[model samples]
Target chain A: MRKLSRSSGDVGKKITETIEAVSEAIEDTLVVSRKFARQDEETLGNAERIIDSVLRRFSRAASGLTESEELLRTENNAINYEISDVFVALQFQDRVSQILALVCDDLNKLEQHLNELKSQQADEGSSRSVNVEQWLEELSKTYTMEEQLTAHDGTKAEIKTDQPGITFF
Target chain B: MAKTILFVEDSASVRQVMNSTLTREGYDVILACDGQDALTRLDGSKIYLIISDVNMPNMDGLTFVKSAKQMPAYKSTPIIMLTTETQEVKMNEGKAADVKAWIVKPFQPAQLLAADSQLIQA
Candidate 1:
């Protein structure tokens, strides 16, 4: 009967050891599961931050493009305005041509008058002087512009006002 | 129907520019190199307006105006003198010729267009 009690005590000790080992295994499994869950959360957070950074960069690029487009539009408008001014300025060619033509006509008349004077001198064999005052008056009558008069008088040309000369009769 | 305008000028460049400007505003333009050339185009056709230059090679603008006024077809046609002349004497001559308006060069396109609008109905 004493032998039987000793065996039963030994079986009880073995059962306690088995229960302790099972408890340790369960604790290890729970730590490993917690570590894996924390890694997954970190990876998800990093992915979200990277996505947010890329989106912000895309937004900034779009804003820059819009600004550049507006600047180009303003520049284009300014260029168009300048071109129109150039066209207006080019109209001076017509005035210059007219003035030059008048000068040419006067020169032709002077040549003809000189030729006539030479013929008269050859025929009369005497120098009949040209009427300087009459010639000058005739020359003055051909002038059409205030600038031309001022040029003939050796005076400074008058500054033209911004008001255009438009007369309605 | 688009109104026909007779544009007479000695300068080729001025004629080209004026032609472009007038045609852009939807007016039919008949170009002439000088006053004498302009008279040839006056062949009894309907002319809405006549724009002429004063100093031209064959015939001058004032003479052209006087001749045009004598024509039975274009006697009452409106005339405008476009020239570099700014003297009162020339202006008086133009007035005597029954010129409707006088515009000095270098003229602004906008000013010319404005004057055109005043004289011509849309």
Candidate 2:
């Protein structure tokens, strides 16, 4: 076996830099996604307004055609319902943002830990290793969603749709 | 007159969605970006109900609920927490803060409206 020596400080520094870069990228993505979501909402709002205006004008012009007016009204209601569903789907951005924020926080912490290890290696000629179990426990404590825990445990998380997690006290 | 509801969430998209949904249901909505901003919006207005996100910058939802409950004007107003957080500990904290309902995020607009209808009388 050939022995290839790499300093712990060098390894730690590389890891820290990588983590920091990833965290920054995640943060930037969050900002861009939020901006896009706002723009999407505005565009949807405008479309809804235009549709409503056209529907109202059509109804007024064709007041004598009662059956056609009713059909138009029904179609308008269905469109509005679909728009509402889009809004609900848009909420995925919020959850994704939250999960990414948490990941960013964890990355920052990991970066900090690496930096500390690098400093220790420089000062003491040896790096103190993190306790994997304790670190995992600490990470689990920060999770707020059940999916996070399930993911951490390497289990498939149940995908919840239409089932509202509601509890009244 | 339409009943007023104060909705607080940090995400702009969620705010827009909630505003549209609540307004469409004939409820007047007041939007705030966070708990701190929500506190400022609670300037003695006759809010029929409140919907808040659990985790937010400046102040979290439970803290805001506790502070809001302290106020004489909104002491008895019902609050529904609409958040991604599913931790039981946080829910217990919310209950202690007088939060009437907890609805997890990505919830259907109908579920939220149903909760609103249940909490606030028509």
| Candidate 2 lDDT by residue in tens digits, A1-169 | 1233356667788999999999999999999999999999999999999999999999887786887779989998898788767867777777778889989999899899989998988999975888889988999999888888998888987747756579989
Best by lDDT: 2
Shift of residue A97 alpha carbon in model 1, Å? 3.1
Question: After superposition, which runs of candidate 1 have C-alpha atoms over 4 Å from their true positions?
Answer: A1-91, A105-134, A158-161
Candidate 1, residue B71: the lDDT equals 97
Tens digits of lDDT, candidate 2, B4-121: 9999989887788779889988999999988999999999979999999989999998889899999999999999998888888898889988889999877877788899999998
Q: What's the CA error at residue A21 for candidate 2, in Å? A: 99
**lDDT of model 1 at residue A64?**
99
Name the TM-score of chain A in model 1: 0.53
DockQ of 2: 0.48
Cα-based lDDT at residue A20, candidate 1: 91
Question: What lDDT score goes with residue B100 in model 1?
Answer: 91
lDDT of each candidate versus the true structure: 0.83, 0.88
**What TM-score does each of the candidates earn?**
0.64, 0.74
- Residue B35 error for model 1, in Å? 1.7
